[model samples]
Target: MTADLTVVHARTLTLDDALPEVEAVLVGGGRVLMAGSREAVRGAAPGARVLDHRDVLLTPGLSEAHIHLVTYGFSLSQVGLHGARSVSEVQARVAHRVLNTPAGTWIRGGGFLLSELGLGEYPSAALLDEVSPHHPVMLYSRDLHMAWVNSAALRAAGVHEGTPDPEGGRVVRPLGCLLENASALVARAIPAPTEAEFLTAARAGAQDLAERGYVSAHTMAFEAPDAPRALQRLAQQGELPLRVWACLPHERLGQAQALGLARTPGGLFQWGGVKFFADGALGSRTAWLHAPGFADGSGTGIPLDPPELIREVGRAAIELGLTPVTHAIGDRANTEVLDAYDALRPQAQARGIRLRIEHAQHLRAEDVPRFRGLTASVQPIHLQADGPMIRSLMPHLESLSYAFRSLRDAGAVLAFGSDAPVAPPEYRANFAAAVTRVDDAGERLAPGEALTELDVLRAHTRGPALAAGWDDEGIIRPGARAAFTLWDRLGGNAQALVF
Candidate 1:
């Protein structure tokens, strides 16, 4: 008998069963043919080419449940301010980029945090100007809610001191920071990438995720419309190595509807969700809060997208068969989103779509159960950097921040991700952080909310698959995809094989 493929002499860690071990697995037609004792497999497919890896542990392929693939790809080439300890360090990097670039070109980079830069206040444009007075420069805070544009960039964008802040955004008084929609002012002035650039970014991002053992990713659309189109191009050209569940930003819903975009299952890449933001992020000091704001007195943070718009668009998303996923980082943001979701519950259920809240990061105890039937697509790795800020800013709610265990107990489906570009999608880092709850400061933030290794694996695998509506993935069993991750251990070294 001719057999398609055989993986023998390996201990399979099938997440489907509670036994914690299986002998081997057989693959055919890009699906799991069988999984059982190695001897049983050899007897069934005697002619198959057997690749033995007895030393390795095999489980289902890991998935990043949330990420911005193209942005992450571009970040690989941009100035990264993620670890810059001071404003001088950020300016130095920007200066270096400016020196190397041609005149009149806009320097685009991001991933700095005022907290990390050790600045009690937003850095002034003067700091960046000292480094690159002639070149237009825009540096985004790590959370992405705010941007610091050098004077040249501000001039290029036509933003002046008298330019009133746009609705749903704020322009810091000193003209150094543009929040939410206002950041688009400077961003619009920057050059849009060519189609080739987009394709390169998509391919690089997909390859990078696959190299890290991610067989699939749920790419949130907090990016330009061209980004997802680039991913689609890659998929069509067969250059995409990872399965992608893409999204359309809420602002483009009207265009998507006009173009007849809807959920497309059973494809290498598909538009499956509508993305919205209820507020900004904690690290950026813009995460919308409740009455008792940040303990450090930054005041209740800024709210971005209104809940009413979420309800209207969310309904449209459900009617069109796309899941609705919102970015809600603070307690108030989460609460407002939940209220909007509750208003759409019946419709969401009727459409067979699971509502998702990306970064469902911090929460009020009372709002915990509101996520009962939703997917909390979260990035545990971020806790490493945000832990101290979380403790200082919202100390009272620190226990519920990244509350993986608590969310699971509250009946929320947890889907793990890296939110890369914001942070890299490193599964090992995620495993350690989620399971250990250790932060950059070496302090354990809400240790009581930590998940077990198994829980982490399950969230990273099966949980994301479910959220993506892929029933035939995230497991080692008959009728499942041949995608598998070979791990040194549950949360250790890993590699992926998607046959």
Candidate 2:
């Protein structure tokens, strides 16, 4: 049944420096054999089966550099609140869901930003209490850094007026919300999904990404361990469509080592990094910042992992052949992480592993250069929503915020993603956010920081490919994996084409 070759005739953008553009590509055995003019490709493989796509544009398959795959899949079935602009709207949505389901069942959903809700202050339990007094309810802010809960759920987790805040997190006053690690108090009480449920979610997530033209993703770990297990099961059954590079939470490093886990590549799924958080996120008012933080006087945000621990564990992770991927949002967090990475850089370089920083969202100009030789895994889609907040909260650092071009010019590899479940994995939004530099309010936060279309494309493709150590992907040339995204135009309607 196998053909000698599969000749794809289209406007191919190889994304290779040598063969930047071609009219046709001949693929066989899941790898590209020749890329050149139609006649040349036909000459290379005379008996090849031809797939003529004359008007379409073929480029390397897109890669989502950061996402919670299973979490996003689960979110698809939950109550959606991403565009809810007012507390009343949220109440209405929750009330509608409450009307359909039986009483007393746990209700969970998220995607509302505090700023978007037009709340002058932290929301109270009374708001949600008015809607679902009998049902336990927990909702997450847009950034997933904060949780909003009703009184019923609060009591279930044993949180009370006298509950002391956990380290690296806070219990907001009046018993309504939790920030950072504090959210885990209530979250732990929620029943875990069964293995079958996990497998279903994994399939849903991977298939969704593949349908959106993504050939691979880097699933950051913050979920139950069962999440990656589901992915592994899918890979074992040969049912996975997208290539996945998953990470383990640093707390599970011991468990990973005990299980004899190491960086094992060349499969549909692989473990490539150990994830650590240096600070919380912006929407939660918990992004650890420098002095004069939050123009509204919220004080410098909370820090999660201590720099010393990051340095020590990071060295161990690198020595184990895993990338030390740290999440650093605020300027102070970035500075501290940079300091830690500086100490571990020599060892990482010796091991041939490039350390990575997720959410390098905000930075100090001085620390910008320190990102040299590091992977800045960022979500430009956040800029569309975070623009006004960045201005209102940290005007002093406005110019340096989301400094994509600056980091790239200073030798940092820019890997773009959407941080799904926080924001939908919509590549068009990423393209618009980075290329236009315009926000929801129609204001340009940092117009000078805008990137060219090609620049953004590379970040979404080649950058992620490098991060995952997949030399054969994210390019369309001889010997490269025959996975491509056919686009109507660059950054336009697209679909995945995997040979």
Candidate 3:
């Protein structure tokens, strides 16, 4: 007996249509050699070593379809304020971090919601200054679409009360917050990490995901150039755990084309899409909406990359055999993106490229059908917190928000992710949010949009694989990759089993 293969005996939920459930899977050479009953598997791979997990549910490995990997890794150490309920609470947390951190160092952190903090207006820089006047601070809102910088940070970035706002972004009055592109004002001032530092962060992020049962992730391109380079280094060094699908910022499309970068799929890191943002986020009240903006008098959110730009660059992306991915949160943004995609759809389909829309968070009744062939890369966990906000801010769109079932029935691929660094890569939260359709306030936001446990599992596994064109990674079958997540209970705690 060679003892070269391993037979994993578990109650398997194979997402494969032919045989949806299997009692055992024989894995070798990082692939599924055979999957069937315990008796059949042992007979096929005689004397193979057994890794028994009959008590746990074994399904295809989990994938975090959207995350800022390196940033999240770095955020592990920053001051966390994810659930602060008041301005005083936020100040206290910042003050606590200042006590331990050296003076004059940048104090960076995020995960706060204005609604949670009962904020009617953006906090003034003075509030943060009250806590850490000596150290420069830049805390992001929960959505990562806004930044709250202290006075010292404002000065460090050369942003004064008189400084004009940058194009397509806003610099709030009283000098505490920056929105959209304006974030670059202070962001450019932050020191860039060395290659070694970048590598450290990349490792931390990837390892964290693997420990939490994710075998793969799709890292969004909303990061610096050093970000992906560090990931590549990690992959080459054989230290990377999660198989990564990377994206290039649309702003760098010219540079990418110049460097001959397109859909280069190999190894652990693969570049497959060009990323764009059609609007801001719902939590930020910056979502680009149609007619009568936010019900709360927040103007029809700030539009980012224009639809014209998406159409132009999207075509070029498709021509290079890459998918064009856009983030659209509001009805108007979705409508505009859908319209732009309509023109680029035929060309994309001709090349076997699929158009993807990230955070298809909101849509009109008429716009739901328009998603028929597009990939909706959405985050279910977001629905948990954004429910109350949706009701209060965009009441008109509440029925259509986070329409998971609607999108699925319309023939759209629903890839789920946590949008980590904004929210933790918490699949349990995703399960609760998507299945219950319950928000933070305990009210059901869109109950009709809810999905079953199996549906969510498929979205987290198979949907992401299809979106990234990694055909062998998401399902559990004879030819599929040998990656599985063992859960004590479905949608509960789990661990990855990878050959």
Model 1 misplaced regions, further than 4 Å: 1-3, 18-20
Question: Could you give me the TM-score of model 3 versus the true structure?
Answer: 0.99
lDDT for model 3 comes to 0.93
TM-score each candidate.
Answer: 0.97, 0.99, 0.99
Please write out the lDDT profile of model 3 over residues 124-155, one tens digit for every residue. Answer: 89999999999999999989999999999998
Task: State which candidate has the highest lDDT.
Answer: 3
Clashing pairs in model 1, backbone N/Cα/C closer than 3 A: none
Q: Which of candidates 1 and 3 reaches a greater TM-score?
A: 3
Per-candidate clash tally: 0, 0, 0
User: Candidate 2's C-alpha lDDT?
Assistant: 0.92
Q: How displaced is residue 190 in candidate 2, in Å?
A: 0.7
lDDT of each: 0.88, 0.92, 0.93
Which regions of candidate 2 are displaced past 4 Å? 1-4
